[model samples]
Target: MASIYDFEAETLDGRPAPLSAYKGQVVLIVNTASKCGFTRQYEGLEALHRRYRDRGLVVLGFPCNQFGQQEPGDAAEIASFCALTYDVDFPMMRKIDVNGPKAHPLYAYLKKAKKGVLGTEAVKWNFTKFLVDRDGQVVGRFAPTVEPKALEGAIEALL
Candidate 1:
């Protein structure tokens, strides 16, 4: 079976970002959007990153526009919004599709590893989260409505 480290993504600046760089860390992967109602979750995600990063937690935000075109901005605009509004310091990847034929490879792997409610593989909406343990195993799948703070216990356990 392929581990999360087997994947790679592009940074918001279009730089190469290999998942291998985060090997052995507890990772929280989120599909984000600037215009979505849950966009405020960025603050909670950033808080988690700041609190547990030293303890090996890494939160990765992937801007996704698949849902209602909530993230309909270029990389620069997304970066600016995240930084200026939410003070997001964690890594934010380039915008990518979370469903359909053009979906990002990492999302494909994630959905397969951890199916959503009722055994659905498709992500229902933006802000959906995937939790990966230190060993690169996909351990949890959270809905867009699942608040970031709600996962603190799970993250602490993994750490």
Candidate 2:
């Protein structure tokens, strides 16, 4: 059984980001957009990352344009926006499709591991979050509406 650690993605700066590096950490994987109404959640997510990172929580953001084209910027632009606007210190991956034929393999694995409402595998929108345990298992799927703070308890438990 392949786990989340089996996947690799590109960092916003274009470096290889292998999930295996986070094998013993609690991970919050979110598909994000810069122009969405929930874009403000970046602040909250950053807060969560700062607050729990010492306890083994890692917040990994993946910029996606599939939802209303909210995140249309290129890698450098996205990185600048996140740093200047939200002071996001957590890892941000390069833009990637979270749906359709070109969806990233990590996302495909996450969706299959934890289907959404009514067992639908498709990611409905941006900011959708997947929680992974230290053992690299997907344990929870949160909708775009769920705030990052709301997952603190769950993350703490995993840590």
Candidate 3:
């Protein structure tokens, strides 16, 4: 019964980031890519972060390159793109796999806690989102097609 707080990941700057630091906060976790079709969702995600962060919401972007090699950028390149293009101020994690054998452990836990559509655990594409409550429980999963702004209601409920 591991909660998200049990996991740790490296930040875009290559520094250790413990999920425990976000304990008791509602978390929006998304697998992102700089060159994917859904990459624009970063704007909406940043909006969510800005609009609700003070109210206990934290948006975490995990740059993933598993699909079509959309996020084929090094740490610096990814960070620069996110900042310059979308003005993303939310925490961004280092690039990592969202599927397959090399998937990050945090993603593995997330997929297990809340299976995708059709009960499948694999992440189909970039921008897939997982919402965690203040208690660190996975409460919802959103497909890549679900726009980040559409999640406001669900996020407000948890807040």
Candidate 4:
């Protein structure tokens, strides 16, 4: 079966990043926005990264503007905002559409791997999360409002 490792994404700096590089790690891939109500989730995400990184947790942020254009900013601008406002240290990828023809390849694979509420694979908003196991299999899909702390137990079990 195809795994998440089969996908590749662009870094915020526009370089190719093969998901295979995250092999053997429990990865939490989140679609993010800077101006949305759920933007504050960055704090919790960063906390999750710090708390479990040594245990193979890889939290990846992909700033997307598909939902109400909440992340309308250039690459440099997003980087500055994350660094200055949230002190974000986790890996963040280039801005990309999460729900259209232009959707990032990584997101496409994630949605195909894990369906959400009502058996829908489409992402409804920013902060939607896809958690993958160590073997590159997508495990669970989380709604945008599901707080990062709430994922601790599931993540621990996967680890």
> Please, what are the lDDT tens digits per residue for candidate 2 over residues 77-116?
9999999999999999999998889999999999999999
TM-score of every prediction relative to native: 0.99, 0.99, 0.99, 0.97
Q: Which stretches of candidate 1 lie over 4 Å from their true place?
A: none
Error of 4 at 95 (Å): 0.4
Q: What local lDDT score does residue 21 receive in model 1, on the 0 to 100 scale? A: 97
Supply every candidate's count of residue pairs whose N, Cα or C atoms clash at under 3 angstroms: 0, 0, 0, 0
Q: What lDDT does candidate 2 reach at residue 141?
A: 99
What tens digits encode model 4's per-residue C-alpha lDDT throughout 1-159? 999889888888888889899999999999999999999999999999999999999999999988898999999999999999999999999998888898877788889889888889899999999999999998999998899999999999998
Candidate number with the higher lDDT (1 or 3): 1
Error of 1 at 57 (Å): 0.4
True-structure RMSD, every candidate: 0.5, 0.5, 0.6, 0.8
What local lDDT does model 4 show for residue 104?
A: 79
TM-score of predicted structure 4: 0.97
Question: What does candidate 1's lDDT look like per residue over 56-78, in tens digits?
Answer: 99999999999999999999999
Candidate 1 vs 4: which has more TM-score: 1
Instruction: Give Cα distance to truth, residue 49, candidate 4, Å.
Output: 0.3
Q: What ranking of all candidate models by lDDT puts the best one first? A: 1, 3, 2, 4
Give the residue spans of candidate 4 off by over 4 A.
none
